[model samples]
Target chain A: MNIVKLGYKNIADRPLSTLLSLLLLTLGVGMIALLLQVNRHIQQQMENNIRGVDMVVGAKGSPLQLILSAVYHIDAPTGNISLHEAEQLRKNRLVAAGIPLSYGDSYKGYRIVGTDHQYPELYKAPVSNGRLWQEPFEVTIGATIAQNLGLQIGDTFMGTHGMGEGSEIHDEHPYQVVGILGYANAVIDQLILTATESVWEVHHHEEEKSENHPGEENHAHEEADEKHSETTAHDGTPGEEREITAMLIRFRSPMAMIQLPRMVNENTNMQAAVPAYEINRLFNLLGVGVDTLSTIALVIMAVSGLSVFISLYNALKDQQYEMALMRTYGATRWQLVWLVLQEGLLLAGLGFLLGILFSRVGLLLISGLMEARYHYSFSGGEIIREEWQLLVASLVIGLLASLLPAVRAFKINISKTLAYD
Target chain B: MLITRSLTFSYDHRATFQFPDISLEAGTDLLILGKSGIGKTTLLHLMAGLLSPGTGHVELMGTELQTLSPAKLDRFRGRHIGLVFQRPHFIRSLSLQENLALVQYLAGKRQDKARSQQVLESLDITHKRYDRPHLLSQGEQQRATIAMAVLNNPQLILADEPTSSLDDTNCLNVASLLKQQAATTGAQLVVITHDHRLKAHFQNSILL
Candidate 1:
């Protein structure tokens, strides 16, 4: 009965073209929104997990891989560096806190990392259950690890020799979960924390068992050199030249940012990598693909706008006399103009709503895939600020697409049309 | 009363129309007969205020419609005048009742559903009020069109070739219905057409 109802009926009468425009708009907006969401997730996950660790020093390899393995615990470590040499580097005045990580073992596909209290302190993850691990074989599991593997406090489970499932099981040295960590929204939530000596002693026990029982369970260590276990003063246990996977270092001042990384690379066998720098490099390398995808989405959106224009234009041509009839019934030119514009705006608004739905569903599917592969849950259901701008852009498209058509409606000659065109 | 003097219009420099003076009192009817190319529709358009004449005066009930602003003229026309054409056009998307409501709304009147139903009933087409215009028969459509025209009860009713496309029986029915509705509303009626069948229905006749 009203202009809005009239405009809506006009669109509803032509379902095919309306649906086509909506489909294109939904796809374009959904693609851009999904890309924006994933980029936000990756940036957030990287930044939060690398908070206090200024640099990583590991055995010589790719600096990016060293940061990925030592800091994120998502990649294989760049070989092992000497613990004695690592301890000597930490003694320097420029280094404030050095947390050494040693890991090559997994229980149920969750990596078991051997490090000190500094690692938990860096991510501010408080032990929510019993306590932090204090002994060689006792473990404090992260929240994700505890939930995924269904391990509770005081539970004991044997760890495999390598980083994933289906590796050699070291059944003799079953690790006990002494505590469970609270959620920190960091990489620690997916790790199992134990003392540095646990990784060393597990291999030590394995080596001796192989020597006595030789050639059984020795294939796992056939490439590793046998270390001489003499009584060492470090922990009062018989040990060899101990090795660690990497050391995560925090600086005493900003001066270390200039000197520390270069000094480690030049003066020692270890390589230093800055987490912030490496992550930026990673994004820079990925930015080209992101740009290309964004351009495609924008192009699709423009085409949807064009489709709206064509549909409205064609409908207007067929309804010229109907419009003239309205004018003769005392409707002003502006009223007729608004009728057309209202149809365009209505389509744009509907397309935007459907597009948001498309993106959120896509994000959930990606979240499930990420949980399965990387154990990083990007459960982002909140709308970011960029979509508001997208909403404005969509309205603009509707307006621009209807501009000429509305003008034509405004300029309609009532006499010529009603005289029966 | 409705009056127009020295009305002139042109689509271009080559095609021009200068209409004769017209005046009609309330509760009476006038029929204007002309051949196809004699500007009968143009004269009706000028009097309905659907077009601005090159030079003229169109006055209805002491308000000079030609002197009003474009927007004001539209409102004046919506409030004071009703127009009908040969094909009995309507907003095809709306049902018959909705079209009447739309007309009432455009004329700055309240959407009086009861009044619209009463008008359609008087015209004997109230049974088809819920149907779309395209779904109605030709006689039913003409009656619905008359129902819409008189829904506002305007001071003037103008019809341009209103019965040109109808058969003899339906043509007399529509012409007499227009005259009866105008007499009921106490409005002046002007019918311009090439169909001479309408001459018998009006008291005053003019040939252009």
Candidate 2:
């Protein structure tokens, strides 16, 4: 019986137009929200994982790929670098600490990273049970690995020869789980960590086994051994040739940030990639896609507003007699105006809620894909500040769309309209 | 009491109307008869405060309609005058019952459902209360309009061609209904129409 009820009833009576407007609005708002959440989660995860690491020194290849592999643990390493060469750089006066990472094996597709205790300390990940890995071939698993594999402390698993699934199993060098880290929401959550010798021991066992047992190793095994020895060449020291996939570096000061990367790239065989700089380049490369999507979403939002305007404007024409009739029944001009405006506001408010729900569904699907592939998921729990601004923008669009129709309702000539009717 | 003193109006110099003065008492019924193009609806609108008169004033219950602000005039008209149009207009989105309820709300009164139901009962269209006005039969929609016009029990009930499109029997029936509802509320009834079949229904008639 009130104006709001009347406006809502009017909108409900015209189902097709109302649905068209709502659909457009939902799509527009949902796409924009999905893009915002995706970008926020990516930037947040990258910034969180690269907090303490200053530079990543790895085999020369795509620097972005190197950062993605070395820092985020999502992609494959470019190639292995000599542990002797990495150690010489780590011992420099400008260096504060270096966490060496050697990962070429996986247990059921989850990477087993061989690094020192400082790798866990860099992420502030505390051991939840048992203890950190100390002996070679002793593994400390991350939270996700333990939960997914149903592995507990003291459980044993063989590492596969390659980073992907279905690789040759290294049953001779099976890893025993010694500890499990708590959920740190970082790259380590998806990794199994151990001492550096664990990864080398797996490959070194293969080389020795092939030499002792003749006519057993294939060309792939021979090639794997050759690549392994090339990166782990001896520095005039016999019987001890260790290689690492990458070294995560931290600087003593900002001066080292400028000089150390150039020194490593020019004077050494290893490639030094700054995580922050590489990630920025990656984002800039990704910016074109994001910007285009945002523009499309914004255009959809504008089209939704236009649809709302057309709906209201068209309905106003049909309801002229009713408006005059209401005036004759004692409604003032402003009441009629408010009635139209309220319809617009109701559409906008409902569209916003439905759009957010749609975005959340989209986020769930996207996070599922990301978690399955990269073991990193976006948290859509909290609404960001920009969405609130988006809400304000939606309301303003609704108000603007309703403005002319409301004015027409307000200025309707009741006497002429009623007489003509 | 209802009073209008020589109300005159014009529409952008295209045409002008000099309406006859009206003075009526409470609880009395009068029929104002005029053909189309004679400003019959105009005079009714001026009386209902839906239009501004070029000259003169309409005073209802000792309050001059011209003296009130636009907002105040709307509320005053809502509280004091009930209008029934020729085509029995209703807020198309609302059911017949809600339309009646909306009328009481517009009059600044609480939406009294019992009163609305009772009015529909008096008009004998209570069975169709939940139906939208457009779904009702022509006779039923006319009854619903009558029910709406008397929902708030105003002091004046103005009907513009209220029976111009009905048969002789339905026309007389509508006229009696309007008069009976007005008498029950102790309000003055005025039906302005050219139908002349309602000429014998009301006690007082004025033809232009």
lDDT of 2 by residue, A1-421 (tens): 7998898999999999999999999999889888888889999999999999999999998888899988998787788888888999999999999999988678887888889999999989999989999999898999888898899998998987665565577888778999999988888988999888777667766767767786777743543423232123233563345788999999999999999999999999899999999999999999999999999999999999999999999999999999888887788999999999999988988888888889989999999898888788887547888888888888888899999999999999989999887
> Local error of candidate 1 at A98, Å?
1.3
Q: Which pairs of residues collide in model 1?
A: none
TM-score of each: 0.93, 0.97
Error of 1 at B176 (Å): 3.4
Q: List ranges where model 1 is wrong by over 4 Å.
A: A210-240, B123-131
Q: Is the docking of candidate 1 incorrect, acceptable, medium or high quality?
A: medium
Candidate 1, residues A1-421, lDDT tens digits: the string is: 7899889888987899999999998998899888999999989999998899898999898899888877887777778887877888899899998998888787887888889998999999999999999999999999988888788998999988765576678898989999999999999999999998788888777767767787674566533222211111233443336788889898999999999999999999999999999999999999999999999999999999999999999999988998888877778888899999999999898888899899999999999898888788896578899988888888899999999999999999888888865
Provide the TM-score of chain A alone for each candidate, in the order shown: 0.93, 0.95
lDDT of 2 by residue, B39-101 (tens): 888899999999999999999999999999988888888888999988988888889888888
Query: Candidate 2 has which clashing residue pairs, if any?
Result: none
Which of the CAPRI classes, incorrect, acceptable, medium or high, describes model 2? Answer: high
Best model per lDDT: 2
